[model samples]
Target chain A: MKIDLENLTIKKAHEAMKNGGFSARELAQAYLNNIDKDLNAFIVVFDDVLEQADEADKRFKDGTAELLTGIPIAVKNNILIKGKKTTAGSKILENYKATYDATVIKRLKEKGVVFIGGTNLDEFAMGSSTENSAFGVTKNPHDKTRVPGGSSGGSAVAVASNYALVALGSETGGSIRQPASFCGVVGLKSTYGAVSRYGAAALGSSLDQISPLGKNIEDVEIVFDCIKGEDKMDSTSIPDKIYKEAEKDVNENKKIIGIPRHFLKEGIDKEVLENFENSVNKFKELGYKIKEIELPNIEYSLAIYYILMPSEASTNLARYDGMRFGFLKEGENLLGDYMKTKGEGFGKEVRRRIILGTYVLSAGYYDAYYNKAQVLRKMIRKEILKAFENVDAIITPTTPTPAFKIGERTKDPVQMYLADIFTVPANITNIPAISIPSGFVNMDGKELPLGLQIMTPHMQEKLLFKISREVLS
Target chain B: MEIKDIENLAKLSRIELSDDEKKELLGEMDSILGFVEQIQKVETGENVSEAGDLVNVMRSDEDTHESGVFTDDILAEVPKVENGFVKVKKIL
Candidate 1:
């Protein structure tokens, strides 16, 4: 039977399997056949994919299948699946295999989701484009000359290109949302601590969140619900009681959306601005009120992210010395061995960030860079929370522009960083945010996708999902 | 930022770079630092407390898994493993 890969959602697939329209193996094979090698979306298409689908088929046969049973999903390479090679898109750990599963991977495995493959990412989730990947860049499915945004570029491509039903991506700053915007998909970055981080490669410990990207809002929400919860393995994971308490404060009648017009004054593409205004008008037509709000300290969000992320990243990356694991290069002495191994193993962007991180945390500069950024981070979070008191959710264009060409911003690190300007504030404040495909813009004679980002107060993912559904519908 | 500062950072980060690479990094790091320098200009006022509440989560000290269950698996990824120990260069 021919499955409609483009319109397939988790619900539709599940109902089809239950009604014997097609077996799990047949559905999985349809997606497997759709995987295109030219896109470079996957680092490794798992050899055991069919075997995993066969197991899901058994669940359906035994009347024990759950909603996620037989669903084929792509995972970001930074996320570890036990006994699989988990390179966070760096040469250092290119051959290293995970010894255990990440908490999210374990949960999905329990739900009978088929592990399709490990998708490519920026090394340590550092860069804004997948161009930094040691394995070649993932091209935007819409236009092969353009890049799929990163560091979750590969996962976003997997969903957008119909290679998988849904995909998991990790975000530190704009990693997940930016790519989803570029690929015209729905991406959700759950509130910090809403999902467990254990067994995922650490980039920025304070900022990283495992997220989901899919073809639409409901599919993203379904995958999020299956994987989110407090875990004993992750101390930062928020307990259910906190989410329960936060749910009490949710005003069901609130329909006012806040747009920080001051933040959108410059650097945004004219077409993207027009699309954003149209999205706002659509909301107004749907009986929702739109208000111009001010977040006074939001301009510093990118600066704070650069300081805090690299500081944490350098500290986190210190573990990859020659003796323990990963690539090793011997030298005349111990220090030389460490230097040679790291110098040769890490890519240019990874090395640059590590050095930047080290400099910020170094003795004389620590107070000036790292500590000041932290204090400002607090101010930004407070300002955002204050805005939430007057608004239901804050909205913005997911990115300043559409998917850029592969090598357009590679030479200029600052230009690449600016791509994330609109998306970083959510990560800075640890709020729940999502990017949904709003519309398209004709760039260079190609209609590229643009995304609308909606952010709610911390742990308010349900509100984001509700508003996202309204916008998309 | 100076070339000497870049050298110092390389030494501190334990990543060796060629002289040409170091020269290239010097320019790149300068721009990146300049971009992030906006934070230093913000008047954070008197109260400079860090963001978010810090809480100490405690759990009983006990073995959650069987001893040595993952010893081989952990050692398998090591670059050099010898007789159940990770082999490394002599410090002295």
Candidate 2:
């Protein structure tokens, strides 16, 4: 009964529910009561909490409930839930209610998952920390002076602080995994095109992906199974025709994991390096062979990410002009209205990316910037594919450092982007990756949580989950 | 990028950025562009990496759909329709 709704992983709660100890409403009330008090972790807790709880209660009572039945989940503000005010931690759409449920919302609703509320995030998922959010930065629940990692910072804190039993986060350039790492939780960035992007606001469209944030591996897999698969509305969605679960007896096999030898060369914090080595040692103890793999191009992940990401983001965000459905014009002329609305509505980081995106994709620069990034992206993907042939999965640190102060990197955008150093590589190459809390670091007498990131080949999510669940348990 | 330059880019992007926003964005733009510029320095050996691989993603000019689209005729269904469209304001 004393379970902090924020810290309790969904898998533990579900196991308890399956045993018939607590009813659905009881679980829903635990989360709702916390949301009403902890205004720091959540933005807008759902108003119809009771109704969804009642529905879930019915399904559970009749023995027809889904795995997520009666479980309370919080969604990052970027993902749409029907009639919910999904702000994406931005003022431009602060008052805009979602007209339609995102594909993830629709799927979760059908399976008796009760949405508790929307959590805060960096505006458009742009920052390494939540300070870039217009909604005010989401504080690290572990230490208030520090930050929760962003742009999925709120989703991370929701689970870390027990504000919600589990939460959903989107990852583009380490948003989900980094936040999860900072908050000491489980986060997964599904393979590109694995989940439908029907209603989520696009940041860097090419890299933007819907993913899950949970307390642990089992919980992440449950949410992943519920929300994944193709949707007609999302053209990028890949059909779930090729999924296979790794056997529970997978430990007996002499599995090989690739470790980018070059990743250890520069910029990694000592704590990060130590934690990674300890994780590798643990994996070896579990009878897995660690292969020192050469991915020379892996060092260039951030360079490629910024180029392709901004270009795609520039195109994806072009629809939010002041004259259209969301934030629109209120000036003397059409162009004036657009200028004023977007100028006032967007924050500094958002505008910076927009300009960068436009400049790269503009006249006389398309072939040189955009097209060439494509060719390089293929080379990187090919390297990952070749690496997979020698190893079942790739292992790396989720982030280079732990959580820093609120404004530590606000002045330098490159410093912020460096936080994605580890997670972004998996995204650029279209692979499934998970970040699990490995240990905490003592940085000058401060405790910082670190994450061990495990990545599997394209669409090899079951194998990814199998490895993560081992480390998590 | 200068503040003025950022304002111009905002116009091209169709988002209204305020003066304060412009000043702040100018600072951010300098750093983002500075980082992106480093990619220009990284040796790719005659191949530069782009942002996406959807090289030939083609959406054909297929037959027009009949559902969920707002046409002039559909706008006429609203009792407050104006100028053959669903209209709202006349602000100066």
Candidate 3:
């Protein structure tokens, strides 16, 4: 039997596979047939796809199948799977192979899920566009001239183009949700520490969160359930009990969504803002109250993210000293070896961030840039908490504009960072936020997808899912 | 920030950027630093130090001592390993 793979959720795949409608191998092959290699979405397509599918099929026959059993999922290249090349889209680690499965991979493997491949991302998950990837840019499925959004651009594109049923993307300040917005798919930036970061390369330790991108919110939640839990390897991973408490406390009767009107005043594309307004009206039509609230520190989010992310990223990336693993280049001396290997191995954007991070973290500038940003981070969190007191969640356009041309903002680093303005607040405040396809905007006779972003207080994913469903449906 | 500042940072960061790259970095850093200067006006209360609510999580210092767990697999991925140790350029 044939089916629409674009709308096929994990639950539907399970039923189809159980009834012998199609073999897992057939599903896997069907996806492989539709892939366009020029899109450059995947870094590596595992050769053992059929073997993994056969294992999942055995789980079904043995009645040990879980939700993701026999399902083909695409993961960002940063998440490690044992015996696979996890490049993090950088040449430095291009030859490196994982010795152990990341915590998320370990969990998924136990449930008999089939990993189709690792998708392309911005090198070390540093940039807002996939153009920074050493491999190539992942063109948006809607328009080849436009980017898929990044550093999780490939995962978003994979789900948007129906190359994978659902994909896992990691966000270091809007990497997942922004791309999901641009590509016109559903992406969730799981609350900081809500998912394990044990196996993922650290971009910003305080801000990075592994997330899910899917065709819809329900599909995203299904993957979230399979992957969300505390791990011994990640000390920051939150307990299921914290998430459950918020889930149980959700008040279905009085659901008030907050809109920070101050943020919408300037710098947003006209069509994107119109689409955002239409989404707000849709929420109102669904029996939810909408309120305008004040988040005074909202404007500082972008500046704060640049400072904090790079500071942490510099510290995290210091491990790639061309010593134990990854790329190496001998020089005249030890310092020269270190400088030459790094200068050659890393891409342009990665080098810029490393220098920027080092600059901010240096002794004299630390108080001015890094420490101040941390204090403002707390202020942003407090402001969000205050806003939540009056509303169940906050709504905004996921991106100021949708899917700009690949090279549009590459020249200006600050302009590129501005693409993440609306989504970075949730990352700073450690809140669960989801980017659901709001509608489409016409650009030069082509329909580009726009996303409505909803951010709820910490561990409040249930509210995000409920509101996203109301808006999406 | 100037080209000299960029050079200092490049040296500190252990990245051997070319002179052209250093000039480009100086201009970029100048603009970025100018943009982030607005954050200085925020009046954080006295004695606000920690970035977030996170604290160091301590675990007992005892090793369970599982033998032959992942030593071989890890060593296999290292670029240069000699006598079960990862080889690196001499520090001195």
Candidate 4:
């Protein structure tokens, strides 16, 4: 039977397999048939994809098939799948293979999901565009000339271009949401501890969260449910009791959404702003009350992110010395080995962030930059939590603009960082946020997709999914 | 940001940088530092608490995996491994 790759969801795929519409192997093959190399969406399509699907098929025959039994999914390269080449889109780990599965990967394996391949990402999941990837940039499926957004660019492209049913991406700030926005798909950046980070390569330990991107909100939600939970391996993973408590506190249906109008005053593209206004009006039309709330410290989110992210990143990335694993460059002595290995292995953006992190954490400048940013981060989080006391969720344009041309902002790092302005607040506050395809904008005679980001209070993923489905409905 | 500052940071970071790369990093770091400098002006209140609750999560002192169960797999990825141990340059 011919598979409808364009419109397939996890539920639909499972149903089809149960009803004898197609075998899991056939479904997996259909997605494999759609892989386009020029998009650079996948670094390596796993050779055992069909084998995994066949296992799913056997489970179906034995009446033990799970919801994700036959579902094919792409994983961001940072996530480990045991023995697979997990590059994280850096030359440093270009040939490095994961020795064990990430907690999320291990969970999905239990559910019998098909592993499609490892997707591309910015080096160590840094940078706003896939351009930072030493492998190559992942082009936007909508317009090949434009980027697919980064760190999770390849995963976003996988879902958008029908290379997989759904994909996993890791977010540090806007890594997951912005790419999902630009690719016109649904992406979720779960609350910081909602998902375990056991085997995913560390970026900013405080900010990084393994997330899901899918063609629709339901698909994203399904994948999230399968992978999210507390793990003994990841101490930072939130326990089930926290989510249960958060669920109890959530109001049944206030349907109130907060818009930080003061924060959206400048730097947003005109078309994108117009589209956002339309989304807010749509929420109003759907029996939702919209309030223009003030998050006083919200504007400083990107600045705070830049300071804190690098500090964490520099500390996290300090483990890439030559001896144990990954790329090794020998030099005259131990220090030279570290210096040469890192200098040559890491890409330009990775090097820049490391330096920036070192400077921020340095003796003379620590209090002014790093310490101050941490204090302000608390203020921003408090303000957001206060706003949530009145409103169910906060809404914003996922990106300041849509997918930009490949080389457009590569020359200017700050210009690229601005693309994440609206998305970083969610990460900073450790709140659950999602980006859903809102509408489209005509740019340069091509219709580019835009996304609306919805952020809810901590661990309120149920509310986040409910509101997202309503917004997309 | 000066070239000396960039050099110092690179030294602290343990990443080598050439003169040309240092020049490029100098300009880039200047702009990045300039952007992040905005937070310095904001006066956070004296009572600004830490970001989140800090809890110590401790696991029992027990072996989770069998000894040498993963030794081969772990050693396989190492750049140089000898006798089931990762080989490194001599310190002395």
Q: Pick the candidate with the highest DockQ.
A: 4
Model 3 per-residue lDDT tens digits across residues A278-340? 998898889889999999988999899999998898889889888878898888888998999
Fraction of native Cα contacts reproduced by each candidate:
0.87, 0.47, 0.68, 0.86
Q: What lDDT tens digits, residue by residue, belong to model 2 across residues A1-473? A: 65545446666667667777677788888766665343366778888988988888888678898678888888998998867888888778877777678999999988888888888888888888888888787888777788889889888988877767789999888899999999999899999988988899998777778999988777888898889987767778875554434233234353898898777768888878989999999998887888989886777778778888888887887766644355554767666666667777787788777788887788877766766666677778888889887888889999888888888888888888898989888899988899999999976577888999999877877788878777666
The alpha-carbon RMSD over the true interface for every model, in angstroms, is: 1.4, 5.2, 1.3, 1.2
**TM-score, chain B, each candidate:** 0.81, 0.51, 0.77, 0.83
- Compose the digit string of candidate 4's lDDT tens values, residues A58-148: 9999999989898999999999999899988888888899999999999999999999999998888897789999998989999999999
TM-score of each: 0.98, 0.89, 0.97, 0.98
**Against the hidden true structure, what lDDT does model 2 obtain?**
0.79
TM-score of 1: 0.98
| Per-candidate interface DockQ score | 0.78, 0.34, 0.70, 0.80
Q: Where in model 2 is the C-alpha error above 4 Å?
A: A1-12, A15-19, A36-39, A244-254, B1-7, B15-27, B41-92
lDDT of every model, 2 decimals: 0.93, 0.79, 0.89, 0.92
> Given the true complex, what DockQ would model 4 score?
0.80
Please name the candidate that would achieve the greatest lDDT relative to the true structure.
Answer: 1
Docking class of 2: acceptable
* Model 2 per-residue lDDT tens digits across residues B5-86: 7666777887766577668777776766666565555445565535566553445658667775545433433324456554
User: Candidate 2 or 3, higher DockQ?
Assistant: 3
Flag the better candidate by lDDT, 3 or 4: 4
RMSD of each: 1.2, 4.1, 1.6, 1.2
Candidate 3, backbone clash total:
0
Model 2, backbone clash pairs (residues 3+ apart or across chains), number = 18
The lDDT-based order of candidates, best leading, equals 1, 4, 3, 2
Using lDDT as the measure, name the better of candidate 2 and candidate 3.
3
lDDT at position A98, candidate 2: 79
